[model samples]
Target: MTKRLQLADIGSALIVLFCLVPFYWMIVSALRHPADQFATTPFPLPVSFQNLAAAFAERNGFGRALLNSLIVAGTTTLLTLAIGITTAYVIARVEFRFKNVVLAIIVATSMFPGVTLLIPLLKLFVGLDWINTYQALVLPSLSFGLPLTVFNLTAFFKQLPSELEDAAQVDGCSQWQAFRAVILPLAMPGVFTSGIITFIAAWNEFIIALSLTNDQKMRTAPVITALFTGQYKFDQPFGTQMAAGVAVTVPLVIGALLFQRRIVDGLTAGALK
Candidate 1:
């Protein structure tokens, strides 16, 4: 006999459907023919590529924005992981003075709203003439992103058996070499989780990008998408706007889908071993 669906199952299905409605609508609106773009049909019929083409058009600058976002997010993710993993490992493994106090302080800073840093950072960058530079974006993101990475990976590292590192050291490996070869590889799940989260956080950011960059070429994908709405050059810009949204969202969506299993593994790390 087939298992019957329970109320909880039905509720979950409803919630998932509700969440997907906007993405579905976005895809449909993006693919709709210009003449019938306003139609509310569930799926786009007689679809057209004009809107997609428009999104990547040189005039739109959304394509360039995508590249800028990729660079910023990629650099931020790598930096956060490199610094965060070592910091987290030290906190987790090595005993030091004010250890809890330092960890607490580090994590507490992440709680402060990023908006609070906006004016201060903008002013500092202007003084240094760093506006519109990749470092301006990546550095601030690191300031916020690094703490969470440290907090998460610290907990993950703590749960891992220290005896594993002991075994590696017993084999003539230096302390650094043991961590490099043994602990870090096993900690992939936590690292992967932190990397993806940091990347998405950096990628979706718009306010900082908008405020920091006056040049259209220096802006991010979301900022460029917002530009599409403000331009009077296109009347009834829904199709083009949705197309921009798709272009901006699809890559992140693909990344999440590809690494979903790893994400699950990260969340459940140390459960079995």
Candidate 2:
């Protein structure tokens, strides 16, 4: 048993190292001077401050783009979670005709490639005159991400004891009151997990934001960062691009760290009971 445990530990360590190797390389390359990036021995420590400065300097309006990404992602996460939690409670705890069919349709729809529907979606948004605006960026993300959020929250809500709702009802609470006061508080971990996932999805969403918005000032960080490369000479400098990548990744890292405890609890809630 001890030998087996040792092997498991070794395997886990190898997996962790493998996962970190790409991040290590990105940090290393990002820190290197562009001239030395492809050098024979390319190992170098990250020049943290210098790279951050360069990234901000060369990427015109990158700061604004970063702000746009944050606003869009934050709005999507909050709205998605709010709608998903309420709807999931109904789906999981309440009996209604065609519930399974509704869920099946949602799951099936999610499997469709997003790119295939872009033309029609763009036209719809264009008809609504939402182009080149924050609404264009956030509304589409919410539409895409909401289904998964509802699915995850439904599963989690089903695992919760119905006794809590009963107790609240016994204490003269309405269904909405019980839900808002009792169930929602208890299900916070699941809600936070869903929000984190939604935020990451919106943050990384490039195609929709890129397609719908043409104004440079209205661009998200991912879209603006992509214009770095040029045919003969790069429009944005290499070090700056690396720095921008790092910048884009930092908020996601922070969000994951903040909600990590909730994520674990949300995943393990069923197992515990």
Candidate 3:
């Protein structure tokens, strides 16, 4: 048993190292002076913030792009949770005709390719004159985010015992009151998990962002990062790109680290049921 445990520990360490090496290299590249960026050294000898600075410089407008991402992702998470939670609760706790069919349909939407809906969405947004606006970003993001949120929350709501809700009703609470005061609080782990997943999806989404917005000012971080140009003629500014990657990655990393336990609990909440 001890020998097996040691082998497992070694294997896990190796896998973790394999996954982290690229991220470490990206940080090294972002911090290295441009002259030494391509060097074979594992660590930068003379570190510099120039690459990070350049990526966020006024000329690049990555700062504005980052803000745009935050707005879109944050708003999408909120809206998805709001609508999805109610819909999930109804599906989980209520008995109605074709309820299983409704759930199957909701889950099915998530499997459709985003690209398939791009043209119709673009046309709809154009008709609404939402082009180059934040709504253009937020609305389409909901299409993708809502289904997952509903599915996860539905599963979580099902796992919660109904006795607590019944007790709330016995105490003079209405159904909505019970949901808001009792069930919602207890299902916070699933909520956090769904919110984080939705936020990350919106934050990292590039194709829809690119297709919807024409103005650079309205562009999100992922789109701006893809279109980043070098200072010198014909150069790609690999260092600056890496810096932008790190900047885009930091929030997600922090969120995951802080809420990892909740995320796991949420994902596993309805698995046994």
lDDT of each: 0.89, 0.81, 0.92
**Model 1: per-residue lDDT, tens digit, 36-103?**
88787887888898888878888878878999999999999999999999999999999999999999
Q: What C-alpha lDDT, on a 0 to 100 scale, does residue 37 get in candidate 2?
A: 60
Task: Kindly list the per-residue Cα lDDT of model 3 for residues 174-265, writing each as its tens digit.
Answer: 99899999999989988889998999999999999999988999999999998889876478899999999999998788889998988998
Q: For model 2, name the residue pairs that clash.
A: none
TM-scores, all models, native as reference: 0.93, 0.89, 0.95
Best by lDDT: 3
Model 3 deviation from the true structure expressed as Cα RMSD, one decimal place: 1.4
What's the candidate order when arranged by decreasing TM-score? Answer: 3, 1, 2
Candidate 1: where is the Cα deviation over 4 Å?
A: 1-5, 229-231, 234-236, 270-273
Task: Compute the lDDT of residue 120 as modeled in candidate 1.
Answer: 95
Q: Superposing all C-alpha atoms, what RMSD in Å does each candidate have to the true structure?
A: 2.2, 2.5, 1.4
After the best TM-score superposition of candidate 3, give how far the Cα of residue 30 lies from its true spot, in angstroms: 0.2
